[model samples]
Target: MAWNEPGNNDKDPWKKKDDKNQGPPDLDDLLKDIGNKFGGIFGGKSSKGGSKKGASNVGIAIALIVGILVYAFSGFYTIKEAEKGIVLRFGQYDGTVEPGLRWKWTFAERIIPVDMQTTRDLPASGFMLTKDENVVRVEMQIQYRVVDARDYIFSVTNADDSLSQSLDSALRFVIGDSRMDDILTSGREKVRQDVWKELDDIIAPYNLGLIVVDVNFKDARPPEEVKDAFDDAISAQEDEVRFLREAEAYARGIEPRARGRVKRMEQEAIAYKQQTVLDAEGEVAKFNKLLPEYLAAPEVTRQRMYLSTMESVYANTSKVMVDVEGGNNMMYLPLDKMMQNQSSGQRTLPESQSRANQSINTQSTAPDLSGRADRFNEGRN
Candidate 1:
């Protein structure tokens, strides 16, 4: 028969016999029964032998002590040298912890270790349109390190991804305003600087707890379809720059030498001008000193001047003339022959006497002496 069914009188298995209603035992009754059993084992003051209340108190104290020990030990954790710990108490923001041993309640608090000292790289690249409407592929890398652990974890959904997006935006913004030639060649450093500045500005308001360490402009190139043409153009530009540099260097090296030559020539001209001026002044002074002497003795100074002039003129002549006192008989001297003999380291007769004797002998021996004299006089005329 079922326990709750009306049937032959069999005692209910789940309830006491004196109770009229048959039902499951209450929580208090079950507790009292367990207490009675524990009290009986410990020799309470009954047939069951001990106080149930005292045994219950002792069991509760032992459970409480064990729970406290487990909670305290579970709170101990270590934070590494390169990491900063962000503690959250009861799922709310708490204080930060530095590197070392730290303690927090196991269930009530949580620790998130963030690496603050390690550098991270975020690479950004894409094909962008230049201001000149040319397409180019540019790649850049940014190095960053975490500065604030709390902000790194809490300020954004993802700091690294945010940085990457910012980098892309900055790179595109700068590239969009730059010419293709600059992006692919000489303007790369300027582009890199602009991108870095733009990226910093973009992320500054968000406080993503990141500091940019360095920016690397890796590479930039024109589209593959026109790569060869652009390469040739770039090579031409490089050669042009090299030629310009060489020209500048040559100019620098030659300019000083040219200036020195011009200066030397100028100094020589000045010295020559000064020497000419001094010589003119000396000649004027000499003429002034001789003027008084010439004025005092007119005939003598005139004759002396004439003789001196004639002497100066005749000193350079290679001929000798002899005047006969009574007649028009003139003798020509072969002074050129005498000079030639002297130049040859040989001796010769005196030019004046030799010329006089030659003229007498020629006149005595010549059959046409009168015609020779006439011809000589014509030549002299």
Candidate 2:
């Protein structure tokens, strides 16, 4: 085919101009022709052995050069102390690297770093009701860390935001489910445990690679909206307690006083019994002292006693009559019978209650009868 042919010109675009009066070959174009002619000479047409191999070699070299450049520029990575590295091969998670310098496939692998340190707190503040119908406000704090690096990378689409959202949900469950009064002060420790447990339950299902350390209650107080009402209720409760305490104190005070009074009464009874026994013993001692003298001389002592009795009787009687042998003039009176008569309302009386009755009853009966004194003189006195 000649370069001037229409069909030949269509086959080779370079011959679009007049081929007989060819212009000077371009340097860039000449180099391409040389490569093509040499490759055809050595290569076979049936299998395209040499030309195919040479093209393949050139392509491979270009790729290697680009790969080497990429590696030299950025291939090594370093994870900080509080960080975890996740390595991905072809956009898929391959392995996880801990805190250290590690080399990975630059073109075929990607690395992601996640913070493994304690994260920002999620403090829950709200008011809720207890089982007993009491309302209280609760304040809480949450601490967490990153545990799994692979899961942090590919298990979830957005791991960090997912962990935070799960934490928020856990806080809501702990605060809303638990009783308000318990959350405030009494069962704070239990609430913290529950919060942690709930967070774990939720995050584990999501595979977000979050690890819960602890949940703590910082400050729990009444809401400002109902502060005055709550304060009033508390004051009422305190008043009731104070009243009960005062009543108990009063009872304690009265018990001691009553006990003292009882003790005093018992002491008085014992003292009276002792005094009576002492008086009886003193009387017995006086009688014992007089017994010896009386026993010394019988007749003389008897006469002396009789004379003394007459003298004393005369000293107390204004008038008296007497008869020897205690005859009819001696007044037949039953003294013992009249003394025991209770209907008379008189006992050891007349002499003490009335002098006239005493004189009528005993005057003639108890006349002076001393042998030493003249009988008539005794009667007259």
Candidate 3:
């Protein structure tokens, strides 16, 4: 038989091996499979065991690389300026970490970034009794900054939400104890400050390291249905105060002037009285000074004063008259003609002056010379 025939014992070209004659695996071929297992055990690159070992090693290397990368990523973290990073090791707080790039243990640690510079707002969420015993709805906003990161993260479960709820409770407590009228008007500012204080007190007991900022009143008013009435009442009160102030201002302006006018009138009255008294005193003094002079020479002064008064009375008149019982009566008593006759020496003198000039003793009117003028008239006729 030829060697290439069915009796040929040479290795097949596809085998590519020198002491190996296995094809693959066969079902129900127990000895063949068992013999092939021994060959593959000793086989090099073409063997299945070597391929499996290499594949497993390659897969293990890929897993190791992936694990190392994860570890590096766990160590890397960024902390912004406004943020604080809190690390908890297996649910236990370690300490506080500030901003910037940082590296920490990766696997068993936890990180929470709390914003340190953010402003939080908390609203008043309940009915509060004001100083006036009214239930007023006052919404307050609180601004806060995170000061302690470790406390913020570990002190409370949810720090921001917890503080918000606590703020409402605190505000209600403060306002419920206050009267409504005071809250609406004067106590609002006090309520704000008190709310903040109470919030601090409530939070401090829990070791919730929170810095309370300002708490301010948002809207302070009565309930909606009574808002208008309150407004009207407030406006009426305002008008009353305004009118009172205006009246006070008017009084302040007029009082001084009124007082000044009264003072001026009083001064004028005093001056008038003083002048009247002075004039009366002057008249009395003058009368008192002249009384003695008039008393010293009563008849002479009276006669002289009477002559002066007659001259003054007759100065404007153009007539004069004199008559005696036993004396001659003139025919024409013209003032100009009598003066001319006296000057021309054609007038006769009266017996009174003739008796006084001749130094003769004259008989008085009481000596009964009754027929003298008749006898003289008859002799002249």
Candidate 4:
């Protein structure tokens, strides 16, 4: 039977001892009963006043301990390997925390985790006026990372946004100072370097705590209306550079050969000079030796010299022509044809011509030209 049914009066679950009411007990009475039970467990007397006081004290202590444990546990957080945690106490800078599990005052402190190792890319692009007042679309990218957590958080309201604006300002300054042709072509690298330097200068005073690792010149081109013309100009510049390099290479190749030819000419000139000097010296020595002989026997020396000159002149003559003194007739000797026939080994000369050649060779080799002078004198006598 149910507790509320008849003959179940003594089995009422909500009924207390010495209670007359059948409904639930009063709130104050129920609380008093709970306090008495707790007080009894803690060795407090069952008197109403002592039980209530002991229970109240015990409950407050237990609640305070539980709150402390919860606060300590909740304060624990982890800093990753690449991050540095910035701790703030009462909305003011406190200290920094390294990677690992860390704890702080739960409600009195806060941590802002900043990634220190990751590289981030920020791009700046716009159509800007060049030094020549020409508008060109230029795009650049900078790789950066946070270096100081405190400065990154406290120095600026927004560090990343500040860096981005700095980039834009630096890029615009450099672009405005550069020519459009350079921005779109060969000067792109130089422009990129200038922008990097300018950006560093701009952000250094602000202390945004960001360091730029690299600056890249992504793209630069004339406006779409002038794209084709710029492309043509760029191609022409490339061709000009290529031709200049080719000309340099050609000059390099020809320079060595020209130098070699000049050296050879110098050597030949020196040899010719030396040979001329030696020949002149030899002629002077010959004249010095012959001076005494010429003084002693002038006629005989003159005749010998004349005969030697005639012999040397005749040695090179292949054909000789002699005119008869009294008749209108000339005699021609074809000595070149005779020599050619003898060399060919195909034709034999007549016996009379062979004897004549032998006699001519013998006379040409005779060594006593001075004796010939004496023979001429004897014939004269």
How does candidate 1 fare on TM-score? Answer: 0.66
lDDT of 3: 0.69
Q: CA lDDT of each candidate?
A: 0.80, 0.65, 0.69, 0.82
TM-score of 2: 0.45
- lDDT per residue for candidate 3 within 198-308, as digits (tens), equals 988888877676787787788788898999998887778778879999999999999999999999999999998997688668756744564454455545644654565
What RMSD does each model have against the real structure?
17.1, 19.1, 21.9, 10.8
Each model's TM-score, in the order given?
0.66, 0.45, 0.55, 0.69
For residues 208-281, could you state the per-residue lDDT of candidate 4 as single tens digits? 98899999998888899988988999999999999999999999999999999999999999998997688668
Give the CA lDDT, 0 to 100, for residue 72 in model 2. 72
Candidate 3 local lDDT, residue 258: 100
Q: Against the correct fold, how does model 3 do in TM-score?
A: 0.55
Off by over 4 Å in 3: 1-66, 129-133, 256-381
1 against 2, candidate with superior lDDT? 1
- lDDT of candidate 2 over 65-176, digit per residue (tens): 7988888778888989898787788998777788988888777898888887757555556565555555667667777766777676678898767866776677666666
TM-score of 4: 0.69
How does residue 214 of candidate 3 score in lDDT? 80
Q: How many backbone clashes does candidate 3 have?
A: 9
> Candidate 1 lDDT (Cα, whole model)?
0.80
